[model samples]
Target: MLLLRQRGSLSASQLADELEVSTRTILRDIEALSAAGVPVYVNRGRNGGFSLLPGFRAELMGLNQEEALALLTAGSIGGRQVFGLGSALSSAMRKVVDAIPAGHQAAATDAAQRILFEPQADLLSRYRLAEGISETVMNEVRRSVLDGRKLRIHYAAEGRDAAWRHVDPIGLVTVRERSYLLALVDGHDRTYRLSRVLAAEALAAPAERPSEVNLAQLWEARSARFRAGEVQFIVAARLDPARREELAETALAIVHETAESDGWLRMELTFQDLRHAAWAIWKLGVDAEALSPPELRDVLHQHAVEIAARYSPRGPTLATDA
Candidate 1:
């Protein structure tokens, strides 16, 4: 139903591939939809597919109060603002709320208020948000993905100057507040950070991409392959119970972890190198202890000594520009 509404029409094979089901299953589902009074129509030909009749729309009447409340509360988190869908989400939510029966509407609204999600920073650590992307560039990239057009992007990759590249935009993905454009360059998979896109242009050429894409599966496979190629420097440590979640968010990866009897967290972690490990542990201040790899402990100790010396009253006065 959603695919028909969004794309106007799609073949059984296309629907099966997108949904990860067999063509037989898709045909059965189509029959089921029609039997359930959904206005599904099929066109039989080499270049034909199924579509919904004009003026036919799936309604919110099927949603019960509890289900509606869950969606309403989830929307209240406001994460859609980062994806440029805030206004659209607001409008959709209004329609959802208005569709509830008058007797249950007040109860559902109250239930939604009982659930709260705060996206604020932690008190003990400095939180840094992801870099912002240009709205114009994002819009252009989005257009290429939705319209199945090739894109020409001026991108600045890590340690490289901005350069023009042509790619077929597959999809857009947001992970841990950072947005990435999953694309194909020279018929190979590539990922680009949205923040690094200095400019983007949609091309008239149609994108040569798969008829169907499982974005989450694609992202997971690419991410696994990326991690496998990186250098791994493992460290064993003890971390504060209160800062466990913070450490997980900040570190490259927590390879292994367990809660100790004493309430602290004991863990094995992987980092890029010695310097990376030292910097991460140092950020936690006294809350984290490097338990092994004598060199890591030595590095942290030396850094602490240097910091103490720089702050000593007898040491050189803090520099000031006059």
Candidate 2:
């Protein structure tokens, strides 16, 4: 309708291409709009096409204070781009901006800029990594998930080539600028990076999933299980006061900790596994020490010995001890 009103007239094929629908669907919509008394009309000549009655300007949809504010805020956050809805969101937001009572639009625009979501403190390292996504493919996956239908995806895991699989998509999520699709394959939940998906096809077959699904609960449960590790171990360490914040970022959790008279922190923490704890302590360098759980200390010692041996002309002989 907007296109008809603004451009005066548009052919059915033009509308179909612009909206990514079949010409038949476009014609059906024209008939439906006319039947609904929307004043839509079609002309039948070389320069003739679909158009609205002369001087038509449809009134915009109504929006409440909270709803209007949400649209403004959401546009600022760029969530639309993550879901491949950038163009659609832009069109919707333009309508919303037009619909907002003239008196409130300026205030709404000003309010959105005050809040921000910063994922990384260092701006230089915070680069967007999303790649190889097309708006059409994303919309297909999104629609299938919402429609309770299965999707045929050509997925490539971390080090594998893409292979087609029919999976039940549970939900989609965006963290930072990357998007993820959580789905079920062979009755097990798996998370796939949207960037790694080579193609997507919304299948007609219904998805096999629980009647009622809570993606958030499922995501958290799966994350906890994956992090809980096969063998849970406790790590005790003496961490430097200045490196406290840095250490916090490295460890999964600090079970317990206290300040010592010498300005070090005596702490017990959980590690997903032995290797996780070793790598974390290794990052702390001289500022932290793994003090207990003989295995953790042993691994740290082994890592340090190997690192030192690499520089010592004493060679592979000493590196073997590590």
Candidate 3:
């Protein structure tokens, strides 16, 4: 019946044929819908078999109040980060709940009493401009990817002046709660974080879709290699057993822990740079040492020398030495 109403209206014979039921069955179904306050009407002869009264819409049949609230809460959260959707989403949800048949209202209210949503602290304080820009760029990128269009973007890179370039928008990705646009630039595809993009505009000419190269697979391989580059040296450490657990949680390096006698721990990890690794080890205060990668050990040694030089007694005055 809902499907028939969605199509505007249907004759009883047509409804029966579509539903694979007898005409009498269709009549009974329509009667049941009317009883449930569906506002169904039947017209005889040359015109209509049945039709929903003008402006009538199907109401929620089985959802309880709690379920309705849960759906609304989720929609609200999504609306906060999405561009221009908050109030409409809230209004639409209310309309849906209000349209529920009278019989189900009590059940919905009961369910609502049992359900709750606690908003996160940062949910209401999200950066609106950034969110709006991200949403716009993402929507445009998706459209471009689907239509095989080229995009001209003003991109900003760390330590370099911002520049504009034309690219074939191939994909969009979300990583660590941030969005990025993946594009084919100068014969290679690379990801540009949307936050770093100063501006983006679509081009008039569409680019040809590449021949069967999987964008997602290429992205994963490239991203992994990029992360791996952050580790420049492998530094081995001997840690006190009690302190070993604390050191293991560090993300600046990858740590390998080994059992050692006398309550000591032997571990090895990769560090991006000697100075950074040295400072981190120093912060551990006493239980850690840079055992391998002589360059990193030298860095620690140099730091110690510098600290000692600062505190050492000044050379005897010339007159005193004489």
Candidate 4:
């Protein structure tokens, strides 16, 4: 309907191609619009197309108090920066507040203010390394995804040199602070970190993608496959509450945690492998103790013995050791 109103006329195939849907779907949408009393009509010729009646304008729907408050609180969640729509979100939020009944507006505003959402980090003071995304590069990638066009990108993957590649972008996903571009490279599934995109170009050619895509499902499937390939090493350990932040930062996953009578946290944690487990537990020093996996305990015991031997006053001097 917006397309017809703006362009005056566009063929069914043209609308389908522009919107990335089937012509049958476009026809159904047209029918729905007509049934909804939109002033839409079809031209009957080879060059003919659909058009809206002259001077027709869609009415803006008003929101109730609860809906306005929900939008207000949600808009404050810091996600609008994903596509650079922060200003637009702010404007929309203002409109929502103003559109609501004046008597309810102040109450809604107060309620929204009291309902606080947790930020990206928890209260443990764990450090998180955020991926840096360039605005110019992001804009280009976003364009490719929205326009359904092929994208040429200069990307630097982990442990690899930056290089150019062409991909058909399916969608962009933002998980917490990091963003990913789900695309196809050489007709195979590939996911690229948006921060790793040094530069990008939106090509005129349309992207080769499925007509319908479930980005969430696709991301989950890829994540599951990736996790399945990693080594799972679980370590049972007791940690001090004061050092919880340090443990959370280093461990791959914390399986379970229980508070002991001695005020220490007994935890079953996961690491990439035995080496990772050893390094993490050792870094915690006396604040943590590894209970299970005798191998880990043995490694720590040997490390402590070596340290004791090095500092022992009665031990051999450097000259004697050499």
Q: Which number leads on TM-score?
A: 1
Query: Model 3, range 1-322, lDDT digits (tens) per residue?
Result: 4555446679888877766679999888888888888888767678766877776655445565556667655654423443234445655655546555656655664565565443443557754333335556655655676677898888887668999978887766654445677777877857787777777777779764575667679778867776586567677888887776566655354557777877787878765566667777777866888788887778788878898899888776844774
The number of the candidate with the highest lDDT is 1
Clashing pairs in 1: none
Where model 2 places Cα greater than 4 Å from the true spot, the runs are: 1-57, 64-66, 119-128, 131-137, 159-162, 230-236, 255-258, 268-286, 290-322
Candidate 2, residue 288: lDDT: 93
Instruction: Measure candidate 4: CA RMSD.
Output: 14.2
- Please state the error at residue 236 of candidate 4 in Å: 7.7
Write one digit per residue (lDDT tens) for candidate 4, span 46-162.
899999998775454667888988898997785667765565676577666656665786898888888877465678976455677887888899899999999999999988999
Name every residue pair that clashes in candidate 3: 65-108, 66-111, 66-112
lDDT value, residue 214 of candidate 4? 93
lDDT of candidate 4?
0.84
Candidate number that wins on TM-score, 2 or 4: 2
Estimated TM-score per prediction? 0.67, 0.64, 0.49, 0.60
Worst 10 residues of 4 by lDDT: 313-322
lDDT of 1 by residue, 1-322 (tens): 7667656789999988876689999999999999999999988899899999975666756568988898899878736666566666766776667667657878888888888765545666656475688878988998999999999999999889899999999999988778999999889999999999999999999999998999999999998877666746789999998988888876777878999999999999877789888988999999999998999999999999999988877524544424
Model 1 error, position 249 (Å): 4.2
